[model samples]
Target: MRSVNNHCDLYDFSIWGNEDVSSGKGAKDENFPVGSLLISRKLRPHVQAYYNFARVIDDIADSEMLSSEEKVKRLNGMQAVLCDDVPAPDRADVQAARYLRNSLLETGVSFDTATDLLIAFRQDAVKNRYETFAELLEYCRYSANPVGHYLLDLHKENADIRPAADALCTSLQILNHLQDCRADLIRLDRCYIPLDMLRAENVDVQAVKDEGTISGLRNVFDYILDYIDDLNREAEQLIRLTSNRRLRMESSVILTLACSLTEHLRKEDPLATRVKLNYKDAIKAVLYACPHILR
Candidate 1:
């Protein structure tokens, strides 16, 4: 939330404050973070501050060494810091903690929303399987939707926007999970796709884990992609409801990218190959998405 004029500073704070996200390792998507930082600057300072805090705590939960219990402790400590019960902890995430305490002092966020995010990240620490799409949506209800709720609250948007924002956020989260399925399986030992869907498609998890190349993979991928397609269409309606042009543009572009990834994956089996957009392509994506981005 601090004025991070330098790209180096933004990247440093993002990485240092969020050492838990290994997904940044493969091919860095600087544009997304750059856009986020720019949007943070354009919006309220507390918006960016809270997001940074959320990201850092998420990273802590995702850390390989930290047990779920330890992650919960860190989150509880963060709550203590948030409530001003104690001095900030000594760690990379502490700057975020201190910033959050200050932000809370300035503009308060509901305790329920705050706790939901921590609980969601904690869910990531242990929960590895989703039994149904409904269950996965419940996960996003905590992990992704609260962000939109916070942002919407910042803008003083009415209850009408919550439904739209919630739908968009959950759609984006589901698309992200589908796109990262293979990597998530390898890295986190987690699968976001519901077990019910897998069973419906007659897919076997053990074979996919072992061979990583089975007909069942293709069928399951098809099923997942179809489900993502429906969410994407639903999210489009929400983009129109957002009053802020930049936020609309940001959300739209990201959703477009998700849709693009799904199309690409549908064209080629991800198990055989992973799809990545080069910098030039990503730049083009941002460019194409610019005109529609409301302010």
Candidate 2:
């Protein structure tokens, strides 16, 4: 294994070439707010650093250009840089890891919160189907839960609030899965909907490729939405549990956004079109979160 400080030669790009597969998406493009105005200005840089690292790895995992082995290798390389097991290569993704490494050091947050995301992205490189909802939530434990944990840690919030934070993060992850169901199937051949649920609904996995959601798929969507509703309810506790005023407001807004998006997913056919919160929904989120800020 190469030492983290081994600054031998720059990493060779010939192995994968210098082509960038980044989706060119950033935090602002996400469905939920990220390091938004609600976050303290002092801490936004750390949040943005984390977001950039996550976005890079997600693109790597989702890339059609890379083979499964190559994707895993790349993700591992990024992780190596993050853990300071090896110096970052002259690449954007690895540089992202280095940036986040600095952020983790500055914030006194656990590096595990960042490393845990790699476990999920690595799984994404190889696993495409979920056997059950339990399996999917297990995936979220690594993929989504760390995000909330990072924020809570940054704000010096109580660890007891983690369950609510996990609930909210997992809810957002599933909502994204539902919204991108068709595109994921077509582009990456990945499916987040549990296989058991599809089997129970008598819906084939390929059904998502249809021009519109079939009745069976819609039923499955509704089932998932019902579960998300429960998660949103559970996540509601985060607002009260968070002692920091800004974090409380941020949690309240995110919970409201999750609930609004859940309702939109229930009514809209994702296969037919993407379901998203509108400006009115944003307004409502702010209105709902305002009381938390005042309190």
Candidate 3:
């Protein structure tokens, strides 16, 4: 499990070579929308390569073993290598830089978005708590929005859908933060729950970390769950924004999963519960996501 402090990036590439559940070749992004995969098969490798590079920083940001100074030093070196400002320091950064550079050359994925991710990763080295939701959203601009922006470029889609995509991406990022709050606090001594919100509810962050879901904190979790519902609604616009059926259907599936997961969190306390799709709902999510073009 990754720490809460590491929520700065969504690139889930494994530092460990992964097994592709699809072809059994290499690893795949666990959170990647299945519909997107089916529709965007040609784009996956380039996307995965970028993710693999992103994971190199993930390895650094989430390392419990390294001190902040060491982590910052290594991240700076990785950044220098990635930007071609310096030589590759080691194998992982070299591979990441090589793949990411190749991806920039071959695909329309934005280099600026990737650089935004680097800035977010750098923040994780030095910062911990966000004072408010607005602050957190500002952070998400760098950490989460870039993934959506990259995807938009990959699809050759214009900015018409970028707003909805950004909402979906940020919602996913927040969902992850809420889901991992307790564990993150325990393992990383970090809490992503907005301090103001927690104080308003008279819910101390440490109490949730130590005691799981207390009744006092239920309101905060419920509010977040409601926000997720709004995000899901906002994302429904994404499916209708483009005429590309593949992209539309892909958005449908991703939004469906988001709605289902948010509904799951409403019923299950994220502080104490780990919610995943049951078999029936998982199948339904996919089926419901498929449009006539795909069917």
- State every prediction's TM-score relative to the real structure: 0.78, 0.94, 0.84
Which 10-residue window in model 2 sums to the lowest lDDT? 1-10
Instruction: Please give the CA lDDT of all the candidate structures.
Output: 0.65, 0.88, 0.69
Write one digit per residue (lDDT tens) for candidate 1, span 28-145.
4322332263255645578667767777777766777777666665666665555543554356566676776676666655545565787788788778889987899899999988
Task: Please provide, for model 3 over 118-219, each residue's C-alpha lDDT reduced to its tens digit, 9 standing for 90 to 100.
Answer: 777777767778789888888888888888787778778878888899889888888878777887778777677788988998877787675468776888
RMSD in order of candidates:
7.5, 2.6, 6.9
Q: Count the backbone clashes (under 3 Å) in each candidate.
A: 1, 2, 2
Error of 3 at 283 (Å): 1.2
Better of 2 and 3 by lDDT: 2
- For 22-107, candidate 2 gives per-residue lDDT tens digits of 99998768899999999999999999999999999899899999999888777777777788646444667667888998899888
Model 3 quality (TM-score): 0.84
Error of 3 at 94 (Å): 3.7
Decreasing lDDT order of the candidates? 2, 3, 1
